[model samples]
Target: MRGVVMYAPGDVRVEDVEEPTILAPTDAIIALSATCICGSDLWPYRGADDVDEPFHMGHEYVGIVEEIGDAVRTIEPGQFVVGSFFASDNTCEICRAGYQTSCVNREVLGTTGRAQAQRMRVPLADGTLVATPGIPSDDLVPSLLAASDVLGTGWFGAVAAEAGPGKTVAVVGDGAVGLMAILAAKEPGAERIIAMSRHGSRQRLAREFGATDVVEERGAAGVARIKELTGGLGAHSVVEAVGTQESTMQAIASTRPGGHVGYVGVLHGVELRGDDVFMTHVHLHGGPAPVRRFLPELIDLIWTRKINPGRVFDLELPIDRAAEGYRAMDERTAIKVLLRP
Candidate 1:
């Protein structure tokens, strides 16, 4: 088996790795069909987060089940499935409340091992893996893979912000997740969607995904643009897809007094001042998205071709050329990179 590993910042390699096997009765092993690099993975890749030792990379995945442990009842071999980054028992109270990422028995896959491989073990198989109607055509693989993480995360961001009919939504950041948020806002009938991005390419895609307007400003200027578009009331909901202090505040300040801010960015070194938020009268919500909760619905949408979230992948590379993919993303030459395992 081959998998991607980062030995140090700017040092990523695809090399022979140990094959995975089911260690728990609730586990299943899947032959990954596709995987991809996530923006969060860049934290350590850029040396922002420490990389003291060799680290396994990748979390987003879609594949065919190869084997399942005895207790894995719902998921079986031959089923093409999409999985979340978090392996959860789905039966827990937290999961039942639609926050499977906080399940009592949860395992973070990227930290636990690697999904950027030909095959990998998935714990709590029945709970975390959602099978499609049938084995999908090759053309649908990438979109199905997107549902595993980015799409689900972006959908969660929109839901947390309460984006729906009659709501004006503003999304901060032009990353994959942010673009997906634009698609999500459109699906739910948001009256207006403002995509705040400085990149022309991302802005074009954002509009295609249903952004009614584009704001290429930053900080206070960005907030003002959003306010101006909404007649000085700001947007009804704002989705912050960049985990930075500036982006977070921009989201908060761009929302109307009673609006919501759903932040889905993996917080890097973000901090907030109590005084700054106390008078905002905005509802703040979001964290690691409970992707499992939305997997089933998202899978259906993908299977039906209602959305094409996989278009986020502007570049595709073989797993062996993962290092190049990382460099392309780091240098802003690619919006998102998809890896064929």
Candidate 2:
């Protein structure tokens, strides 16, 4: 089988690799129906995160189960499923509390599962994989794939920010996750949604997803703009989808006292000032999104065609051209790249 491997920063290649096998009674092997590149994949690709040697890449996936271990019960062969980046035992105390990403027995995929291939082994199959209503048509594949990670992550960010009716929401990033956050905000009937973005394309998508206002500035200027739009009290809920120091600060500063801030972007070199946060009086919540907790609802929305999150994929490429997909995303030529396996 061929899979993507990052030999080093700026050096991604599709190389033949050994196929995955069921290594645990709770595991299942699935033939990937679709997969895509994540913005966080750029962390190591741009050399932000360390990479001393070659390793498999890609985490977001939607696939058909080809085989299931004897112990697996909920998931079975031939069923189409959506799963998150983390493989977890959904019955754990933490997972039962709606934080499956922090489950007691959790496994990291993408770095270990090598999902950017034709097939991969899913750990804790019964807990991690959620079967779709039925085998979907080709048109539903991308949206189902989005539910696997980005949609769920964005939904988590919005929930963390406590977006809801009669509250103003501000998102501090224009990436796929940020855009999805707009959808999440709108789904819960949030009013006066604001999206902070400089790119015209992303700005348009933000509005399409329910953003009523757009702020082109960033950092302090962006914070000021958000306040200006909110009548100087700041917004009631702010979502930080860009995990940079500047974006994080902007999100916190853009929120009013007693508001909430959801930081979802993968933090690379972020350090929050204690005094600043102390003075802000904002409720903070976010980490690797408990995507599993939201998978059922997100999948239902997609399956019912109530949302079109798949439009986020502006670029599509064959799995063999995965290096190109990474370059396109790194260069910002594409919002999200869908890789056909």
Worst 10 contiguous positions by lDDT, candidate 1: 108-117
Q: Write the per-residue lDDT of candidate 1 for residues 1-341, one digit (tens) a residue.
A: 89999999999999998999889999999999999999888888899989998978889999999999999999989999999999899998999999999899999885425998899999999999999999999889888988988998899999999999999999999999999999999998999999999999999999999999999999999988888999999999999999999999999999999999999998778889999899999999999999999988898888899998989999999999999999999998998899999
Runs with alpha carbons beyond 4 Å of true place in candidate 2: 110-112
Error of 1 at 99 (Å): 0.2
- How far residue 205's Cα lies from its native spot in candidate 2, in Å, is 1.1
Instruction: Provide the TM-score for each candidate, comma-separated.
Output: 0.99, 0.99
Count of clashes, each model: 0, 0
lDDT of 1: 0.92
lDDT for model 2 comes to 0.92
